[model samples]
Target: MAVNPPKIKVLLSANERLQKLKEAFHGKYKESPLFYACAPGRVNLIGEHIDYCGYAVLPMAIEQNILAAVSVNSSQTIQLANTDPKYKDFTVSVNEITIDRENPQWHYYFLCGVKGVQEQLGLSSMTGISCVVDGTIPASSGLSSSSALVCCAGLVTMEANQKTISKVLLAETCAKCERYIGTEGGGMDQSISFLAEEGTAKLIEFNPLRATDVKLPEGAVFVIANSCVEMNKAASSHFNIRVVECRIATKVLAKARGLEWSSLQKLGDLQTALGLSLEKMLDLVEEVLHPEPYSREEICKILGITTEQLSKNILSANTHHNLICRPCVS
Candidate 1:
């Protein structure tokens, strides 16, 4: 017998908040004034550290998503509420592009989207909005909860303003706004979240900002086991470090070969240009750096390196806990 994978869904129960939201705007306008939009969270299957370097990444939008409830207000102040009452309401002006420090820690991300949209359309002022946001996307799990939230907010705001908003523009606005969160991500999450089709993976090429949808193989199940280790893109400098390291490596390799790094179109091209196998590249890296590469005790003995040095280098590289490889889903 074939085993079934676990299914997850957003479960919103009938409660006081739901009743109040319905009552607040049931017949307020001439037509149905309520607007709803969904934005999905993204999962990166491979190409983790290569996005900023203009490499191809494979990602998919999961079932987890953010659903937004929005209504336009006559005033110039935007008001937002979360399902968790402890999370304070966020209020900001359409004219003022300032960061909210008190309420949601991800407020900067939203502010970025709002400002981006305003700048994109040359809109001097946006109508005030009352929005209630709820989502099933896991926060701080390497899944793109922040991007989904920003995309959902942007969509509602655009709809409320009666403007034509393209998905490409929405993704760009969300990614640009998320920079306020203090992490320099390459816009993969927002792009994938907005454009990804269900049951398909997207291959995104950075710099030029192109996406290709690739269907997943039939009868294949994707198992995403969270190691319970979470890394915050904004709070941690680790992601940036990996980006810089890859750039440095690329530049060094290019200079050694008397060629520009931009000329190399693919990662495999870089390896071929350097005439180095993956193991040989690792060995060269060990030689260039002070300590040797990561190796088990027996492997170190075979390579004639001291175990202590090998262990220390491995720790420095954080190889022990890294998500090294993932199977191709498309």
Candidate 2:
């Protein structure tokens, strides 16, 4: 039997939070929003950083989300407002949309989603939108508030333009577009946000991303508690550094296995090429990689590649601060 996917509906009348958001939007814009789009924040239960290495991650949708009240019109500009007073209102001409990565303002993340959808659909001109964003996810909580906002915006844009796309397509597009704001994500957040079904967690895998329902133990309750300490993964280079380290590890391991190392860019790709189980992959990491860091010169010599090829083909935009690749560890 074909299973039914979870239904996501706009039930403002039944949801107090959504109702307040709608009222607030109507008060600001003087008209009721035509429709609403929402994307929930996700909690990664396991396989956190490994997702970028093209591994499967276990994540579940939380109650907190980013909700947008939207209306399509012929205003020729996009207007944005937030329910929270701290975030000031922003507006931009549809013809001249721009996102600034350095500032990382609240609205710029919203634009990342808008611009992503616009480019994906290849719309010469977009329907102008007046949107009010209301978010329950705490910012910088490691719970994917920014990604939820981006996903929500992508949904809003698609709806405003009267376009229809599959959840997988929307998830993939939103994942790629979020990098415009300097985040090197692995699609875990967007995938879980769109693919999550009520009453079950999901195992989200990438490289032709798909989600499978995971049954939880009976009587188990998952609770999310904020540490109150915030880390913006995009604002810092630590996340990218880890990604580059993994990429380097993949190439090195491929070379050790007599595979064409240059073509391999992810740990998961290497794992697939070797046809090894996860346990075997972990064993291989220990057998081939050293605890000490590898310099670029040593890596080049080991891989039989020149320094120029290493820089041109392997290094990421932010990984050039040093020539050392960190030790590989699970």
| TM-score for candidate 1, residues paired by index | 0.68
Tens digits of lDDT, candidate 2, 177-248: 988887888899988988987888999988788889998889999888888998887676777778778888
Candidate 1 lDDT over 78-161, as tens digits, reads 777666555466777777768542233755655666676777777877888877666677677888887887777777766767
Give the TM-score of each candidate: 0.68, 0.91
Q: Against the true structure, whose TM-score is highest?
A: 2
Cα displacement (angstroms), candidate 1, residue 90, comes to 1.4
RMSD of 1: 10.3
Off by over 4 Å in 1: 1-33, 100-104, 250-330
- Residue 94 in candidate 2, Cα distance off native in Å: 2.2
Give the Cα lDDT of each candidate. Answer: 0.62, 0.86
